[model samples]
Every structure is written in structure tokens, then in C-alpha cells.
Target: MQKVTFKIRRFDGEKSWLQEYQFPYHPGKTILWALSYIKDSIDPTLTFTASCRHAVCGACAVRVNGQATLACETLLDKMLDRWKTDTLLIEPLQNFEVIRDLVVDWEAKVERLAEVKPWLIPRDEFSKETGCRQTPEDFKKINKNSDCILCGCCASECNKLSSNDRDFLGECLRFCVSGK
Candidate 1:
């Protein structure tokens, strides 16, 4: 395709609308790059959050065609191929308050997470001075859970949260505290 089109859902605190933008398509470009290109070259008013472009930081997570994915790691070509279209619908993650165009508010989520007491209470064997050391096997058990970057993807895709957000803590926070 010569060009790719993006229909992005934009919110400015009170009002919400869909804004369309098109740009020349390039091979091996990621969704994050496309967002950056639009913001930098096309529309300076566009708002989104991204950091640690390596995908370790989940700040770049967004709903691409109704599914939550890390924008930095998702290739535009892959999305185009998967959907068999040149146009993509981008929206803020579901089950969160939208702060701006594509940015969601984390303040409430953080507050809810704190209610779970996600931290561990140290045993008498482990103290601040000596520090706690765990065996490789112990670390391995919680390794996968520790990888959660709080990107809100799991929460966004969670059916339970969509239905009853007040009761459900969402998968990400559950997994995070479960590991601890």
C-alpha cells in the first residue's frame, strides 16, 4: 500500500470524536512510529504517551482494532496484514478514564491497586540491612508475573472489568499481587 490511514478516537476531557489521518506507508514501521510521525509531522495537537520505546515500559499500549497491544512492539505491516486493510482504528484502552486523545488516567487504577496491599511483609529472616535473597527456583516461580509493566492491556481486554470494574481488580494487578 502507498499510504495507511488511521481513524483515531480522540477525547479532550469533555468532548470525544474520531479524527482521521493518512500518511505514506513505509516497511518495517511500528504502530508507535506511526503515532509519532502523525504527532510530529501532521498534527501537533495529537496526544499520546510513550516511553522506553523498547516495549519494557507499557506506556505505549493502546487498543488497535479493538484489541489491546503494545504499540512499540506491534508492527504496522503486521496489523495491516492481520486485518487485510490499510486503515486502522486506534482507541484508548477500555475500562479506564481517558485523560486525552489516547492517554488514560492511571490515578484511580493506582489507588485501587494500593487497596490490595501488593507488597510483601518481610519474614524475620530477611531485613533491610542484610536484604532478602531468594533461590533461583523461587525467583523463577514469580518471573512471569514480575514482567507486568502495568500497561493496562490485561485490564482493557478483561471482560470482568468491562462488566463490573468496581469489583474486579483486573488481571494485571491480580497477577502482580499474586506473585508477591
Candidate 2:
């Protein structure tokens, strides 16, 4: 087994700091697995969000080597191979307030989505059994947009929102709004 070093930016409300962790490299392991190992074995106080480990849920989003991505979707071997280093740097997503280590507040996005009326409001009255109907062609129009898991990756990478500016509605919300 090889040794890998992970440098993580940790936040605890009042302040934030960088913390280093060491892990035994295993082929084909994802970044999420390494993070889990760190939290479970190395530091019990560490915190992050993860759900639907298969990537369907967007809860495990974090910045890896300065790129916004999902931890579960990022393979450790691939990242090391691509970056040509045994060290990985992880931090909370950009344009968000960190609530804790690697966990950012999603309330802003939720609020924006609420403002946009993200779901369809049927004009015509319909029964519970009749449900809303849509043609195949109509369904296809929003199919791609519907794939968004609201992971905030697009928002984190957006040029419109830097650390200084975060009042703008993110791409994820725009996509969801358009899908309606």
C-alpha cells in the first residue's frame, strides 16, 4: 500500500484551518472513501455531507484540487494520476458559507429556488388519478436539465460568483427553473 496525504480546509463557525491527513492508498478508491476513513478513523470531529453514495444525490460536493466536484464521483487513483501527485487538496465549495468542515450552507440556493417557483403549477384542474400529462417531445426538452442533482458544482465554478459576490442565482437553480 502507498501513502497519500490529504490537505483539507476545516471550518468551525468562528474560524477555519487546514488539516492534513494520511491514508493508505488503495486502487480504485474514491475520494469519498478516503474522507470517510479520515472522519471515522482519524478524526471523529470531522464533518461533511454525503448521501446516495452512487452520485444521484448532490450532498457530497466539495472542491478537489480547486475544482468543484462530487467526492463520491472522484476516484483517488484517477485524481493522483491526473495531478501527478500523492497529495490532494480539498475544501468547501466556492461562493458558499461554510457551516463546518467541508459542509456549506445550502439555504441560499433553496431560497432562490423557492423564489423561482421550481415546480409546475397546473392551470387546469385535474384529478389525483389524471395527473399532469406531457408529450414525449415535451418531456425530451427538459430531460437533460432534469439530470441536475443540485450539487452546486456549476455554481461553485461559475465566474459570476466569486468569494466576494454570491447574491446571484446559481446555474443549478436556473437549470431547475428552466426545466419547469
Candidate 3:
């Protein structure tokens, strides 16, 4: 087991602190695993949010060494590689308030999706019994956005969303609106 140093930034409602930890890095080591190890055997004070250990759930997404990625999906090598060359700044995603450590206020991202009405507005007479009829071609037209898991990754990196103006819904809007 290779020891990897993790310098974690932590914040509660009242105060903030930095803590360094060391963990064993294996071939397929992930950021979530590192946090888990730190949380378990190490400092229980460190706090974050994670779920579904797979990338399918967005709950574990955080900025790893300054780049936004799902913690469960990103390999430790990638993070360590970047860290070795430069100091890895692991901060919560921009444009959101830090609830604690890596966890930030994610409600705003979901609110943005709600603002856009991401789902298709039903036409008159479209009934549940009938099920909104659509062919494969219709799906092909909107398939590009079908993969959206509401991970908020795009919003995390979006420059426009960082601005104070709340009107701009950001890139997810483009994805939602792009009917092609």
C-alpha cells in the first residue's frame, strides 16, 4: 500500500480549518475511498457527502485538486499525478455555499433545472394511459441530453453561474434546449 497525503479543508457554520491525512493508494483508488478511509480510521471530524459509490449518483461529485469530477469515478492516480506537479487545491464547487468540507449547497443547481422546465411540457390530450407517443426518431433528436444525470458538474465549472446574477441558468439550459 502506497501512502498518499491528503490535505483536506474543512468548514462548519462557524469556523474553518485545514487538516492533512495519509492514506494508502492502490491501483484503482478513488477520491471517495480516500475520504471514507479518512473518515473511518482517521479524523472523524472531516465531513462530506457521498452516495452510490458509482458515478451514477451525483451526490459524491466534488472538485478534486481544483477540477470538478465525481469522486467515485476519478482515480487516485489522476489526483496524485496532478498533485505531484502542483499543489492540489481541493475546494467545494464554486457558486455554492459550503455546507461543510467538500459538501456545498446543491439546491441551487436543482432549482436551475426547475427554472428551465427540463422536461417536455405536455400537449393537450397527452394522457398517462396513452403515454406520450414518440418514435425512435424523436428520441434521437433529443438523445444528446438523455444522459444528463443532474450531477451539477457543468454548473460547478460554469463561469457564468459564478456571477452574482441569478438569471443566467448556465450550460445545462443549452443542453436542455438543444432539440437536435
Prediction 2 global C-alpha lDDT: 0.86
In model 1, how many backbone clashes occur?
0
Best by TM-score: 1
Better of 1 and 3 by lDDT: 1
Task: Give each model a TM-score.
Answer: 0.92, 0.91, 0.85
Off by over 4 Å in 2: 163-167, 174-180
Clashing pairs for model 1 are none
lDDT of 2 by residue, 1-180 (tens): 379999999988998899999988889999999999999989989899999899999999999999988999899998999999999999999988789999999887788778778666765865688887888997887777777788888888877777445566555544744545
| Residue lDDT tens for model 3, 101-171 | 88888676667768768787767879989978878998886777766766667677777777753777554
**Candidate 1, which ten residues in sequence have the lowest lDDT sum?**
171-180
Question: RMSD, each candidate, Å?
Answer: 2.1, 2.4, 2.7
Clashing pairs in 2: none
